[model samples]
Target: MGDYLVRAIGYNGQVRAFATRTTETVGEAQRRHNTWPVVSAALGRSMTAAVMMGAMLKGEDKLTVKIEGNGPIGPMIIDADAKGDVRGYVTNGQVHFDLNEYGKLDVRAGVGTEGFMTVVKDLGLRDMFSGQTPIVSGEIAEDFTYYFATSEQVPSSVGLGVLVNPDNSILAAGGFILQIMPGCEEETIESIEKHLSTIEPVSKMIEKGMTPEQILEAVLGEEGNVQILSTMPIRFQCQCSKERFGAAILGLGVKEIQDMIEEQGEIETQCHFCLQTYDFSEAELQGLIDEINA
Candidate 1:
């Protein structure tokens, strides 16, 4: 019912899949960013995919997905960890347009036809992994599908959708990712492709109150074929805090804090992820200066 993702192996481990119901998670982001309808779709879809990709990691590992398109929405960034926590934002959240020919949000027009999607992974031992591919389609799902196939060399099917209300709130948001494992039979891949063509959109399934497990079954087309491995709660979670920002201020050295104490009397910092503001009094600034001086 709430936001959560499921991991499963289908066709007796010949395929790996992930499904998530992210309505509440995307709703929280919609409220925080006040994104318009089209922009909401773009940001929500990217966040949904990012959280699933995060689940692919382990321990302290994490990743960031950057979508830089040439349209009005500007660049979007999402950060996610292995723990099912995610946070994201768009450079321009107030942009929207009329529906396209299919009577759906014009996400392609809002995202533009060219640009790049990049993924950066932090593996926590100074070892990093990064892959980038041109945005094959401004639609978030196709772009990720291309990313995995071309960048990671894995054949994948990605379905992402977000529906917004007239009042600019999120109605439903969810997605599924299906990847063919090495040595998968030709028959299995053909069957999955056939189902992918017929299954309803991910947003519609979520709107109809389907659970993540049910969504996976719908995509895989066999209720008994999926073996759910794990489930984890997902949400719009930001890691920024006052202490983290304070350390950043201290890294700015003594003169900057002194200037704030004298010229501005205090310093205030606002987090881009959550828009939460942190203020440091003149005394607090002085203490930071002392720490820098010491």
Candidate 2:
């Protein structure tokens, strides 16, 4: 019903898979950013994949996915954590185009055929991990598929889709990821490829009210072959807050706060993820200046 993701091991641990129903989550993003149809698809697809990747982490670990393409939509950035929280935005949310040759949102055209997809992971402590791959397809799914194979050295299949309503709202958004574990039999991989070719798009499945578990079964073939290991709720969650922004203002040092107090009288900061604005009065700015000097 609501947004959630399923992590499962299929074929008796021969393969690892993840599927998520993200309609509501993507809807929240669309409403916040007011993204056009094609841009909505691009952002929705990236968010879907990023949340799943986030599940691969543990504890306070988090990761950010950045797609920089040479198209009208500009660069897109998404951040997700191990807790199933994700937030994202496009450089230009208002960009859109007529349907492509397939009568679907022109995501490839909007994303462009050249660019890079980069992933940066913060593992907490002093550790970090980063990987990058060229944007082979501009379609979010295939680009991630390539990323895993080349950057992470895992053979993977990724399916992502987002349908937009005429009013520029999200109609359906969801996706699935399948990875061929080491020692997987050739027959198992062949079977998954066969089912992948026949199943409907991920967006259509979500539109028909298919749950994430059902999606895994359909993609992996046969209900008995897929074993769901865990399920976690997902949503469009931003870590930004007024207090956090205030702390950032303190980090700007004493002079900047004094300039705002004297010249501007106050400061207003708007979060790019959720579009929530935080206003600091002159008194509050002075307080920050005091803290900085203290």
Candidate 3:
């Protein structure tokens, strides 16, 4: 099935749950950024979690997740919105290393532990909501779990995993988040911890053809209560274009555009998001100047 996420509530609102299959989403990002095995694991895990987090919002609200780890992979960035739109890139996409002793992708080596993950949320307000925390674990799922429990003060369990192929491509990618709401019972909390301790890694479950619903079931158990909220598609969609680049030049003011016109007769800007280049011809630059002065 095409990649998508399922949002649900469990135990009659005592918990909020999210699960997603991000293979295709991560695949698209791999193609766009040309990421290798280690970087793919890091980026895929972040994207999977970001998609689930995006599903937590309402219309026109969005968020950005940034991991500035001091590892070979450089920075890992992800963006997501309530409409299921998401995109991201890694600065050094070709980073790779030997698998960890657990025979898994060395995401820790790719995304070192000496950095931070910061989230910027746009809730359609004058000022965006943001949170930042140090990278407690280079393994993204734990870091995000820490982010929620500490930064947001919400008890959460994050299971994010990405299996990489021998040829440095994504094999499987997915994750889930189970959050405890206010007034949760002590028994409910113990049940969740027990399930997490025994449950398989989220990526392994995805490879076994588990749907988002099934993933949630794995976490909540057959006897557990789950209320489906909504489902949404997920993919790599970059909202970058030449027109947006032109507007950026306008923001630079008339003199900057004029300097470009005089120096090179034209200018080209490349988007870091999609790596797509935008060129403004001399005439276009002149028009931008006119618009700026107007």
Candidate 4:
């Protein structure tokens, strides 16, 4: 499969769960940003979690995840919507470090142990829902898990992983989120805790060719205990386009356009998300100025 997410419930709806395989999606991001292995792992894990959170929204709703850490990687930003479209970028994409004590990509070293995670959700309402939580772990997954429990007041478990090839391309990326519903039985919670303790890192499972469904099965329980609700395709999709950049140029007003035309004869604007560059020739800049005037 290209890339996809799974939405399901387990233990008779006492647990709300999500799982996704984002190898292709993260690979595209790595290619666009030229992220090194540690940077790829950091950005990929954040995107995987953000996309799963996006699935929790209703139609036309979206969310943005920002991780501003004190590490060398600086800040990472991700945007995801209800339709499984996600895009993201890191402030510094060339960061790398020796593996940590556990022999994993030193994501914490890249992400840093300080700073905050902020999530802004646009529910198509007059006011957006925003939450901020202290970063409990530099690892993206634990930080999001903390966000849920502290900011959203929902007890949840989040697992995210990304493996990069020696060449710094994405090898596998995937994650899962499990939430305990109100009034969930104690037994069910204990059961999930036990499974969580024993399950392998999600990236390893994905590297081993496990699908989202299988990942959830391993996390939740046997096939019978989990009820598959729906599946949505996921991908790295950017909302940027030449017209959007043109409109932004128009917003910059005629004076800036004229100055750019005089100085460079043309201008190039690159999108932070996809790194696609849009060029505006002198004529195009003049047209935008004309539109601004009229």
lDDT tens digits, residues 1-294, model 3? 999989899988898999999998898888778888888889999999998889888999999999998898888788999988889888999876987999878899899988999999999966698999999979999999999988899999999988877676778999999999999999888888888899998889999999999989989886558888888888888899888888888899988888999999987788776788888899999999998778
Pairs clashing within candidate 2: none
Q: How many backbone overlaps does candidate 2 show?
A: 0
Each model's C-alpha lDDT? Answer: 0.93, 0.93, 0.89, 0.95
Candidate 4 C-alpha lDDT tens digits along 1-294: 789999999988999999999999999999999999999999999999999999999999999999999999999999999999999999999987999999999999999999999999999966699999988889999999999999999999999999999988999999999999999999898899889999999999999999999999999877328888999999999999999999888898888899999999999999999999999999999999999888
lDDT of 3 at 275: 82
Model 4 residue runs over 4 Å out of place are none
lDDT of 3: 0.89
TM-score of each: 0.97, 0.97, 0.97, 0.97
Residue pairs that clash (backbone atoms under 3 angstroms), model 1: none
Report the number of clashing residue pairs per model.
0, 0, 0, 0
C-alpha displacement of 132 in model 3, angstroms?
0.7
Give the lowest summed-lDDT range of ten residues in model 4: 219-228
- Error of model 1, residue 66, in angstroms: 0.9
lDDT of 2 by residue, 146-180 (tens): 99999999999999999999898899999999999
Tell me how far candidate 1 lies from the true structure as C-alpha RMSD in angstroms: 1.2
Highest lDDT among the candidates is held by which one?
4
What is the C-alpha lDDT profile of model 1 across 1-294, one tens digit per residue?
A: 689999999999999999998899999999999999999999999999999999999999999999999999999999999999999999999986999999999999889889999999999999899999999879999999999999999999999999999899999999999999999999998888888899999999999999999999988887339999999999999999999999999998888788888999988899887889999999999988888878
